[model samples]
Target: MIVLLGITLAVVILVVVTWMLLTRRLREKYAALWLVIALAVLVLGIFPQLLETLTGIFGVQVPANLLFSMAIVLLLGVSLHLSWELSQAEDEIRRAAEEVAILRAQVERIERAISSGKASGVEDADGVG
Candidate 1:
């Protein structure tokens, strides 16, 4: 009963991750990571003793401890990746804002020149005025 439940849960997770990828709700890289994780879960479910062997190989006393440690590391890595992406987005936004300010200043200058030229009755078509 427990083995069947574990397999079903892993399959469900795999389906959900694939659906998210197809719907464009998740990025390809993240989807790939999830797919790998789901596959690992499926393998672990099919052969529960694999986890025990892994724990022993890694010098861990309990399989649950190794699993929790891996989960924590994965979460930390994901958090770091998101932070880096946010920093890049912020840098891009700053550059875009600077460009907008420069363009706004140019537009304001052009408007002032046009108004002054009209008032002084010295309209130059080439804008040499």
Candidate 2:
């Protein structure tokens, strides 16, 4: 019964993630990661004996402990990845802001030159004055 529930939950998650990916709401990189996680859940749910084998191999006293450990590890990995992505985004935003500031200054200087030329009726090589 519990196995069936787990499988159902995994399937639901998989479907939702797929929908998000198809709608462009989720990036391909994140979709792929989520798909992998969902597939893992589905597999473990279908064959719970695998979890028991893993627990025995790891010398865990209880299967719940193994589950909790796996959950913690997965959460930590996801958190780390998100943090790295945020850092990269922050750097890119900072660079773009700096570029915009430089461009704005240049634009202001050009406007000042044009306005000053007009006020003094300066003529260029073309002599249009």
List model 2 lDDT by residue over 6-125, tens digit each.
899899989999999889999999998899989999999999999999999999999989999999999999999999999999999999999999999999999999889978999856
Error of 2 at 117 (Å): 0.4
lDDT of 1 at 7: 90
Scored by lDDT, the top model is: 2
Give the alpha-carbon lDDT of every model.
0.90, 0.95
lDDT tens digits, residue span 1-129, model 1? 777887998899899998998899998988888888788888989999998999999999999999899889988988999899899999999999999999999999999988998889785887664
Cα lDDT of candidate 1 equals 0.90
Which stretches of model 1 miss by more than 4 angstroms? 124-129
Task: Go through the candidates in order and give the C-alpha RMSD of each one to the true structure.
Answer: 2.8, 1.5
Candidate 2, which ten residues in sequence have the lowest lDDT sum?
A: 120-129
Residue-pair clashes per prediction, in order, are 0, 0
Highest TM-score scorer: 2
Report how far residue 31 has shifted in candidate 1, in Å.
1.5
For candidate 1, the 10 contiguous residues with the lowest summed lDDT are 120-129
